[model samples]
Target chain A: MKRVIFGSSWLPYAFLAPQILIVIIFFYLPAAEAVRASFYLENPFGGGSTFVGIDNYKDVLTDDNYVRVAKFTFWFSLLVTFFSLAIALLLAVKADTVLRGAKSYRILLMWVYAIAPPVAGLIGVLMFDQHVGPITDVAALFGYKMQIGVNYNDTAAAMIIISIWKQVPVNFIFFLSGLQSIPKAVREAAQIDCRSSWRRFWTVTFPMLAPTGFFLLIINITYALFDTFAVIDVVMKNEPGSNPMTLVYKVYLDGFRGSDLGGSSAQSVILMALVLLLTIFQFRMIERRVHYT
Target chain B: MMETTSSNLEVEARAGGRRTPLLSQRRFWRSVGDHTVLWLGVLFMLAPVLLAFLTSTHDAVTIHRDGLQFLPGDHFGETYEAVLFGATGFTGKATGLVMTFNSMVLGIGFAVGKIVISMMAAYAIVYFRIPFATLAFWVIFTTLLLPLEVRILPSYEIVQKMGLLNSYTGLILPLIASATGTFFFRQFFKSVPDELLEAARIDGAGPFKFFVDILVPMSKTMIAAIFIIMFVFGWNQYLWPTLITTDEGYYTLVRGIKQIIQVWVGANIPEYGQAMALAILAMLPPILVVVVFQRWFIKGLTESDK
Candidate 1:
């Protein structure tokens, strides 16, 4: 968009070659192959595949297990996005109120953003380990037995909790900044009109935070969909039948483990559509409302 | 001024006389509530790490027998030594050190490669008037949605066909063409003042000279910010390396930690101590980067969102 320019056509192309090459080779080619393969029944081995138009998609759409996995992924993404946003909003509001030690609190809450999903998963597994988990000891104090590995609900709960924990720091960073960006004068004006803190927050602060909330909603869903693949992989490695098998994980499982290339390609294409829709929605709707100031 | 001061003093005295106990109590409770919530958040964040570190210190027998120990044990030195230099006693191929090295290579390679390519792409798009430039930009931008998870099978096949399966290039290159980085750099470059470019042109500096001198220097903070993000991302890659690399020498720390936990001896128990140590090792570099570059990290996130 700049008016000032440099270089001829060939020079620009030369500059673009490396990125274009990689994108085509790694991204476009594979994406094209996935789309193409979705329509064909391919052998798991390197043998040639037969074009079975819409059959792979039909099988995936009708498969009961795929339905279950899709349902689980929907609920998982919802719960993670909701709880992480709510918890982060609470923490950010509280941290914003503190007149002292706010920096230390922010630092403490923020460093966890650096921990990878797999590491967070390992931490969750260790904390919830039935035999050696300290959380089980705490649960014993409450007179409840903690058996995460054996119970599907418990395993699903662990995955959700870890996903929320890993995601809260990111949401917190955004929400805290959002809260700070709401001018003090606006809050004070509201305070003069309405003395109740809760009412003031609802009428003034929450509406002001809508943009950030919407943005984080999209980001958290994207994260829950894709980024939690490692977390689920680690937590459910021993319990593959657990309820936390998201669509992304299912793609990997069906393609790599089940060796169902055509089926997995269908799943992949479906996931791509879902992500593309979410991304387009985010850029179109949510981005327009984001208040930069 | 005297009238205003006296009025202010009168108001302060009247309020102080009546509101002291009620206001002090409310303020005390509010402070207490804030600190309590903040500390609870801190505990939620740090407890897992503390427990991981604590469990790493103890011997596996004690852990297996007594469950997770809250207290630190005496095996810290020995456990870390064994994890770093010693073998897992099952398949003694990739040690903790070698895996760490591979992880470092992958992380640095991935970050540097992404930065270089994206910078050039952004520079060309922002500074040059090439044909189909907008189309090219959109093509790169659309990649934001096409993560590896969506195209895993074919991507793996493509890398395999390229004979880069076990090499660092295979591990890093495919993941390096990032839409986020290019998008970020394009925005950053667009913000660079036009006068700077004009001045450089007037100075008879060539495009390469202007880029290496003025642009790269100006982009140092942005580079640092992206470096922190991309390094952590690259270091934590799990599925890609797992799919591509079959050799032990190419194993990264993140993948290696999972392997340590999964690798089981026939009769012996899993190496919980070593696994914990490796987990801690894997966490160190990224945590260090975040802590060291905390300012730039936050800045990058905020700016990129804008």
Candidate 2:
């Protein structure tokens, strides 16, 4: 895009070679390998592989446990995305409104963003530990026993909670930045025209935030799909037996632990397709967005 | 982050002065309600980590009996000392100090490698003319669609084929293949004024000189911001490190979180105290970086992704 450009064919390629070589070796090679491996029935014990067209995909899609895991993944993504976004939006709105201790609130609400997912899960595990968990003790007070990593729903609930907790800071940052970027003229106009603050927020503030919200929706869904792998892995205590897991975790379990390379590759290809669809959908939304400026 | 808006201050001042008692009371209650919501949110974020820190101070037996401690205990010094300096882990070689070193290597190496390579790549694409430039750009940026997680198996096999397992290069190289940094730098380089390049050309400055003299200096803040974000990302990485590093010596602090719980399992009361201490050590550096360089961190995070 530079008007005054350097015209050196070898120099450009020389500079690009490292990034391109890395991409080919790591990204492209593995991705192509995944797609190719998906079509084969490969033995894990160092043997020949049979080119079994779509059977691996068929096996994955038709298994009952796979179906169950898929259902849980869907619900997990939805619940994590919805709760994290909602809590972040509420916090951002309140933080933006309050003049007292606002900076303190902003810092406190978002510092947890630096904690890794597994670390968050570790804290969650301690919080929901069977013996030493304060949250478990609180649950006992309420007559609801919490058995994380043992009871299916209890483990799922804990994972979701920790995932949401880890994710809130990210969403909060984006929403707060979005709220701050809203023009003062529009805000004052809304203040004069609308008597009810709630109504004003819905009509003026919320509409202005639709772009950020849309951007974050895709981000949150992608997050729930992949980045929560650490939390799920840690909370399931490294053995995901009948515990709920996102699709990403299942791929790891089947591929690495289970050593079903062909089957895992099939799942990988499926996830790649899913991600591509989501990204394309996101781009479409961005293209169609009504730019305020 | 929370700038004091003059308009908001003026509105609050008006609400407090000469307003009807009824209106002022309602305004005060609304402010109180706002503060309450924020407090709950802060508490929700803080309590788990606070409990983790507090529980880290107690000895294993006490923690096992008392649940998570609400307050610090006397065993804090011993716990932290043992984790940091004492020979621990299944191999007795993966002390917290060693893991922390590995984590720092990964973080700093990843950020520096990414920024350097991405700058080169972006500089080539933006400032040079090449026949296969479009193809290179497309191939590089397409990495954004499929994350490393999706192709973990194949990637592992590839790394295995290359025998990169247990090496620092293996840990860092494959992860940096993505074009996140390139994409960011490309956008930034495009925004840079064309006149600078023209002037440099007029001054007979070659591409390398122009890049070194003008662009790199201009990109100082950008590099710093990206460094912080990438440092946190590399330090926080769990899945990749979990797979590639079979050696105990290569365990990163984030990757070691699962290990603490897994190894100590059924060892009587388990070393809950040390585990929490390790977790604290894992989180502290990145948290400090983000909180300290908050503005640059936010910019790197919020801008780079887009």
Candidate 3:
């Protein structure tokens, strides 16, 4: 993109070799491997795999357990994406309005962004631990004995809550930055046009933040899908016995513990397609949003 | 003129007095509401950390007997000492200190390696009119579509076949294969002024000399920001490190979490305090980095989204 540039034959390639080499070995080779293995039934034992065209896909698609995991992943991503964005929007709006000590609030709120998903999940497990958790005690007060990792719904609830908690800081950071970027003149004009602050926000500010919202939506969905792998792993304690898990976890479980390489590869290919679609959708939206600005 | 202005202001003030107090009251309530919501959000973020840190200070038996602790217990010194200095995993090589060292290796190594390699590739792309440059960019760009999670199994297989298991290079290199760093540096390099390059060429500076003397110095802040972001990302990586490092000696703190859980599950009265301690240790560095370098951290994060 630079106007003035160096024109060299071999020097540029020399510089790019390390990166290209790593990408070939890691990204492209493994991606091709996933596609190739999806067509074969890899023997769990050391014996060689037999080529079974489309059979692995069929088994994974028809399996009741895989269906359940897929359904959970769908709903899990939806809930986390929705709630985190909403909570973050509210906090960002509030933080933007408050005049004093906004810096302190931001540092407090966004520090959690640094905590890894599994570490957050570990803390979640402790808080929801049936024997000694404060949350379990509170739930008992309401006569609802919260049994995380034992009851299916309770485990899902813990996963969703912790995932949201881990996610809000990033969303807050984006939303807060988005809110601050709104032009001062626009806010003043809206203030004159509408007397009520609530109505003014809906009319003026929300539309202005659409680009940020769309970007964050895609990000939140991706976070729920992939980043939560460790969170689910820690919460489920590596035991997926009827416990809810995202699609990524299912891939890990089937590949590593189940040792059903073909089936896992098929599921992984399915995930790859889903991510591709989401990314394409995101790019289109981004292009459109760019046009508006 | 001054008296007329003063009388006009006095009249306006007297007329608007009742309306002003009501508006002020509304604002007062609004401020209260805002502070209340923010405080609650802060507490939501703070409670888990506070509880985790507090629980770590107690003895394991106390934490086991009573769920988790709210206040510091008497075994603070002894517990941390044991977890830090004690070599006590099944493999007996996973001390807190060693895992921390491995985490530093992953974090610092990942940041440095990513920056160096990405700068080179980005420099080649942005500064040179090389053949197939666009094609190279696209190949790297498409990687953003398929995450490491999707290709994780096969990646593990390739790494295993290549005998990279339990090696730091295995843990770090595959992750740097992404185009994120290259994309970042390319955009940054494109933004550098053409006059600088023109001036350098006029001074007869070669490409490598110009890069080292001029571009690198100009990109100090950018490099620092990227380093912080990449360090946190590498330190927090769970899946790849989990898969690649089968040896306890190679375990980073983030991946050491699984070993901790396994030990807890096997133990009679799980080491709740030590588990919390390890979890806190895993979180401490990243949190400190983000909090301390708040501006640079936020800048790198939000800008990269674009």
Candidate 4:
């Protein structure tokens, strides 16, 4: 005990202080404040808050808008993850096989990925907005009169499309690397055995990509849930829509606009809990199926 | 035995099929397919950007006249001048100067502070074995679990309380102590061999000496990669900066450019040529960074996979 104590006595604490300080100041304290505020009914403008345990959470959970937002968050995450991963895998496999200009293609993809999400959203607004947007003009070439920016539903669709556009490149990079790391001989032998391209991919390529896919699935879902909501918020600010805002947006609306700090905090806490549970579940269940080698 | 052998040969020949064409038909077709798909994907990705570029180069009056043309024209010089120097007779304050300054301060402060502080912290954590280090680390990393947006309101309050509102400190401070950077540097430091440290110690090198001589020298590539990524992330930050910075002088490039688009679209549609030029300019630095670090970025991504 003495030796262990001596070995550990000062170093860890001293070394860890800076990091701990940051977390306390930036993360933990804020989180605690949020949780505390969630139980208190207060006006955001000024004055002290009164404690009202569970009421905020109850109010938010029972609200129809909240339920709608939760459903939207779920559906958005599910579809984005599914389509992004699918298209990414397809591109990766094709890129790996074709091998011509692959490097430049990958780099270009990352360039797009590096561009800001809000910028992308803004660009979407420019391109698709009804009055005199280029996208509207382009659509007119095909005799389709689609008003994108003005309509909340159309805006959401544009958001999703842009999300996919920006994301495919990064996801493709991950999947391609995963595919490339698998030995070429396994593929050659499979091919020599008269296995069709589709069959070989399903049997060989897809299995190898499981680990990358799993990581991306977790990260992308989290991103779509939390990060993209802000972009959507900016895009849809004060727009009329039953366009089904996500839980994150609802939190933003409730907190910043509604000035119901408690309700917003409750919603945020629930969001955090949902993410944690899902992440833990993923690690426990999906990690086993991920073929690391 | 001879019949069986002949049959096997015939089957193999059949599987091989007809002779490849002069250019090797299979290879040619495969190449065609590859090029087509690649070009298609590239076109899809580049189309909007190209359109925006075109629109920006064309004066607003002509844009409505031409209606979504991609060809470059004389308006490039005109629009470029307007975007940089401001429209000769437009209402609303010019945002170019404010945006550029804000972006520069935020990017430099965030990137430099993050790298320096993270390096120091990472060094201490890996080398010193401080008390409650694991717990401390867990606490630090727990911040990563919450997206910045999650606790943004409280953070806003905190910044307001600190009187950091409309200041560069507000933009820079929140970004400085990233868990991502700390974790990255820790992983890099942990990979350094102990024998090097012992040898350095024998040579009378202290912790600072050892770090400056050994660790930083060996970790240059990682540093470059981290700097590029962090700079890009900082430069691209929008919501927080937008929320905190109410002053026209504190608008970042993104906010400024976005405002231009909004104001142009809302009021005078003719100023879009200038808006497009500014947008293109705003995009250049991040693009250049990516281009410069392309090789290191790929290697960094691949290496971290392990």
| Interface RMSD, in order shown | 3.7, 1.9, 4.0, 5.9
Going through the candidates in order, what is chain B's TM-score?
A: 0.91, 0.94, 0.91, 0.87
State the DockQ, from 0 to 1, for candidate 4. 0.39
TM-score of 2: 0.97
Candidate 4 wrong stretches, greater than 4 Å: A1-16, A138-144, A237-244, A285-291, B1-19, B87-94, B261-265, B268-270, B302-306
| Residue-level lDDT tens digits of model 3 in B1-77 | 23543454445445556677776566666766777788888889899999999999997778888888999888778
Query: On residues B1-306, what C-alpha lDDT tens digit does candidate 1 reach at each position?
Result: 235434544454455557777765665566667667777888898888888888899998988888776789999999998887876542367878888899999999998999999999988889998788888988888788878889999999999998999999999999985578889999999999999988999999888888889999999999998888888889989889888988988988887755654653233655666677888998999889888888888887776762
**Model 1: per-residue lDDT, tens digit, A1-293?**
77678866566788888988898899999999999999999876677999999999999999999999999899999999999998899899999987656777788899988888888898788788877788778888999887775777788889999999999998999989889889989878988999777888788888899888888888899899999998998887534765558999999998988899999999999999998898888888665785533
**Candidate order, lDDT descending:** 2, 3, 1, 4
Candidate 2 structure quality by residue, lDDT tens digits, A162-267 = 9999999999999999999998998998999998999998999998889989999999999999999999988988778889888888899988888888889999
Q: Write the per-residue lDDT of candidate 4 for residues A95-143, one digit (tens) a residue.
A: 7875345676676556775667666666666677676677677688999
Which predicted model would earn the best TM-score? 2
Clashing pairs in 2: A132-B67
> Any runs in candidate 1 off by more than 4 Å, and if so which?
A7-9, A141-143, A290-293, B1-19, B89-91, B264-268
Q: Which is the winner by DockQ between candidate 1 and candidate 3?
A: 3
Better of 1 and 4 by DockQ: 1
lDDT of each model, Cα atoms only? Answer: 0.84, 0.89, 0.88, 0.70
- Per-residue alpha-carbon lDDT of model 2 for B196-293, expressed as tens digits? 98888899999888889999999999998999999999999999999999898999999888787687556678788888888899999999999999
| Model 4 residue A87 lDDT score | 77
